[model samples]
Target: MPNPAHATGTDLLVLHALRCVGFAGLARVSEAVGLPEPDVESELIDLAVAGLVTRVPGDFGGWGLTEAGRAADAERIRDELDTAGVRTAVTRAYEDFLVLNPELLDLCTAWQMRSVDGVIAPNDHTDPGYDSRVLERFADFHRRADAVCAELSAALLRFQRYRDRLADALARARSGALDYVVDDMGSYHTVWFQLHEDLLATLGIPRH
Candidate 1:
């Protein structure tokens, strides 16, 4: 009894990732899916060929899902959820995730930038004390986030990966790899974004 709603192929996952992440570079998509850059690029190409997604070339461009892709994903993912009959449970979990969303974003903002002279400034990582305080808050936040992830995984097993990824990112950040907090490819923000996408996809909700 595998979860049929979970993405079965790399191409679908790539397409759906773009659908939720909006537009993103190959590196971002690769990191989000835990796939190699080359593999993600290959899958993106196939999805593009099928007209389910498109790649935009430029400094501010990457890949995105086409209208058709969005429609197809909605229909397919909705059918999967309905078939699994976990809508009410997943919806309740989504509500709980929403409650934690703002706090998570606040933590990410604090990690990336901090208050300085009554103005927000980028944390230069020069102050060990400030960094330690942020890390402590992050640890506390993760404890709460773990509960949300647990609820989500209970509703849909595919979501368990997010809990693992977020914890790994926080651990790396705590160990002095500061980029793991928000700006890096596998940062907590990146993992959280994927979790957000997964919830919307699982519930067949639109980003807007």
Candidate 2:
């Protein structure tokens, strides 16, 4: 059996990152894979040479997977899960994630909007008390989320990045960096969404 902590290198990491994150620049790709830009760029170049990915030009341009890349990612990821004998473990983790998914969505909504004068209004972060309450709930939520992430990372090491990124975002938000909660690119909600995408992609499940 293959090792559970598979070091697939940038080969599958970069390709599968694009598969899950969609079209993204070098920086976003690097962030997704927890690797340096130069390393990701080199992998992207090699993938492009193999006709698995392509870099688009102009504004809003970025690296995206080709149809071949998508097919390849699906095949390889399935093989990896089966070879590692962790498909059932990962599937259980994914099910646990689904249970937590709704609570997370509710938390994001609470962070972005609040009831004011009996009317729903966008959160302005001007109310310290309200913000503190939300942060408290987030801290509570993170404790449960961390458990699920631990289970996932045990089955597949690459999933550890999500655990790390999610914790970092929450830590920053607790430290008063409000944007880390939902606004920034590496925000808690953003990483959660990517993890959702990654799970779907790995399981070969179509997004609804």
Candidate 3:
């Protein structure tokens, strides 16, 4: 049977993407959902019409979910999981993700900070050897993380995008885009953080 949850869910994808990523501009939303800017804009406009999202115009403003949007997302996502009967699978994957979560946090901390001259300091990327070791650890952690992501994608196709994104971030960081490690908006840490939020939202779990 076709999963009703995955099929015809572009609107849900846009809504839930905003839910996970918080307020973001069109470019970020497009990137998050792997949709073209025009298409995402169309969806946003329609969602705005429905009073599910609103846009703020300013130097720092972006699109965000309305209160009704949040409620709708919660209800729909719960229905999606229950309809597809994938709660157990997703919950198991989430548990696996938790196992690897601390390690990734440590790796991110290692990337952003280092011991220098017997003092802890922000990583300045001046030491290629130290940076290389940290990158190597990130690569190792990604290998394990990929397995968990695979399980999620298998359970819900929407999750495949995260696996692809995390890989892209790691590949870019390894290829000398240093900011991709944790600094840029689309950095590995940022995307990982979004995924964490997504899992919690999809499972209807509170952040606390």
Please give the range of 10 consecutive residues that has the lowest summed lDDT in model 2: 1-10
Candidate that beats the other on lDDT, 2 or 3, i.e. the better one: 3
Query: Can you rank all candidates by TM-score, best first?
Result: 3, 2, 1
Q: Could you say which candidate leads in TM-score?
A: 3
Give lDDT tens digits, candidate 3, residues 99-182.
999999999998888976899899888899999999999999999999999889888889989999999999999999999998
What is candidate 3's local distance difference test score? 0.93
lDDT (0-100) at residue 25 of candidate 1?
93
Predicted candidate 2 versus true structure: per-residue lDDT over 120-187, tens digit per residue: 99999889999999999999999999999988898888999999999999999999899999899889
Which prediction has more favorable lDDT, 1 or 3?
3
* Residue pairs clashing, model 2: none
What are the root-mean-square deviations of the candidates from the true structure over C-alphas? 3.2, 1.8, 2.0
Supply candidate 1's per-residue lDDT for 82: 74
Cα TM-score per model = 0.80, 0.95, 0.95
Of 1 and 2, the candidate ranking higher by lDDT:
2
lDDT of 2 at 53: 99
Q: After superposing candidate 2, which stretches have Cα over 4 Å from the reference?
A: 1-4
lDDT of each: 0.80, 0.91, 0.93
